[model samples]
Target: LHQFDPQDVNYNMPSVLQVSGPLDVKRVEDVFCQLIARHATLRTRFELIDSEPMQWIEDTVPFAVEYTKVQAAGTTADTDQDTTTDTYTRVNIEAQQLVSRFVRPFDLQAAPLLRVGLVDLGVQEVEQEAQHLLMLDMHHIVSDGVSLEVLTDEFVRLYDGEELAPLRIQYKDYAVWQQSEAHQEWMQRQEAYWLNTFQGELPVLDLSTDFARPAVQSTAGDTIEFALGREVSERLKELAAQTGATLYMVLLAAYTTLLHKYTGQEDIVVGTPIAGRPHAELESLVGVFINTLAMRNYPSSDKSFLD
Candidate 1:
């Protein structure tokens, strides 16, 4: 998909971390370099090999932190008290702009799809601590949410001068195991289960919208936020416990009920992401190990919530 749509930035996972007190820029850069050296996915790139798309992991990749120092804006003699607040605001704006620019599409054929940037906001007299914003951007092909957490934890450990234990296995080892004959048999069983589940004609959900459907599908959309109060949340949890179902199952039931009410569809299929790390060895590795699970549910007006 990335190869076809090279301009899309949707797969770019960007994160920002704020560091307080004094910071060593060189040490931070070294920490990033160590992280790349530790994780094989960090040095991976994709290209066509024998007419098939394949990933190649390089032994090493050059990495450096792009540092930017933000200067405080001039303050009038009368606004000395507001200088700290004003400086913070200015730093925030500059940091946001830098992140926006840093989050661009990556070339799949290029190794080290990761980019790091640091913004030094200097020291504030009120806080008496220097602040720095660290930005990390990586392609989704090489990393996922869990991988980002691993990177952050390892980064902190390295910066604090703690030695990390060598990994027993890398992502490449996991990939090799996935193609083994034993894994193939297990995968075939799963394939059979899904084939049986979706054998019949699937129902198409048709929810009424304000405007006519476009000729082509679009990634553009808007989001609305709503919260279930504490009482309702607790009640839902209690219901889940009583019914021996997870909170996710209970919430999914409610969501499907809403869809049935809106579209009058009895059968609905929804897709949700699942962490695909099945082995203990894969837990600490930095890689894209996520899979989508398709859930098919039947909701009827006559059935109670429990049913």
Candidate 2:
């Protein structure tokens, strides 16, 4: 985020969590605050010290909740239930608005880079229950996809009045340990292997494009959805099993093959992201534990899919 322009939205990670159940505003607020208090990463901030980046976790950070109520026509097919239709429509619109507000960029210096919003879905007459949508906005600097899941599970447990056991170590502690002498020695042992693997100059991939590339890349992007047929899925699995390779490796190899065909480049490099948690104990920690590794695959014209 620091490398990009101030207004760039590259590091924003907005998540919308919709739940249909009765919600007590005060209880929900308390639970949300407790969730932030429990995780040190949520309260961390980055700063420059002598031209080097460093992290510091605040003892406590401010937490606030914004609430909104809406009323609109509903979309239920029941012609006689006019009121029900309006309630459902209102809920849907409000939920969308909440999500829109959640995706805005955050200021790194503003510690406790998290925001929470609540939408009250009045009441459901049939069940005599209330529904709600909880939206959370976070910066990618401190949290990632896996960390969000960890937060959700803990939030549920805390809301149920279950006390959580203390964490073995916080993210900051792990950061300090990574730079220690013991860790450096361990890393030094593998230096020769990495040097040998990446000895040559890396090759750049030149993909054919219909349109000219922009001077500066845009952060705006959308997801493309596609589905694999059951037969194809099974075939891929069988091929992976026959070759003693995992499904991900099989898929990656196929991707490399496509690039080789398109660009006609024998030396191809593809980047894949991996969960960087080296220790079993780090699995439960909520923080940025992701690393990207470049895969250099040399595909020959004679190589078959199974090979």
What candidate 1 gets wrong by more than 4 Å, as runs, is 73-78, 81-88, 124-128, 222-227
Tens digit of per-residue lDDT, candidate 2, span 142-186: 988778888888888888899998887888888889999999998
lDDT string, candidate 1, 1-307, tens digits: 8867899998999999988899999999999999999888999999998989999999988788999988744444465667757776877788789878888989989889999999887775545678788999989999999999999999999999999999989998989999999999999999999999898999877889987778788878898999999999999999999999999999999999999999988999989899899888888999989889998898977899899
Clashes of 2: 3
TM-score of decoy 2:
0.87
RMSD of model 2 against the true structure = 3.1
Question: Which candidate number would show the highest TM-score if scored against the true structure?
Answer: 1
How accurate locally, in lDDT, is each candidate? 0.88, 0.79
Instruction: List the pairs of residues colliding in candidate 2.
Output: 73-86, 74-85, 74-86
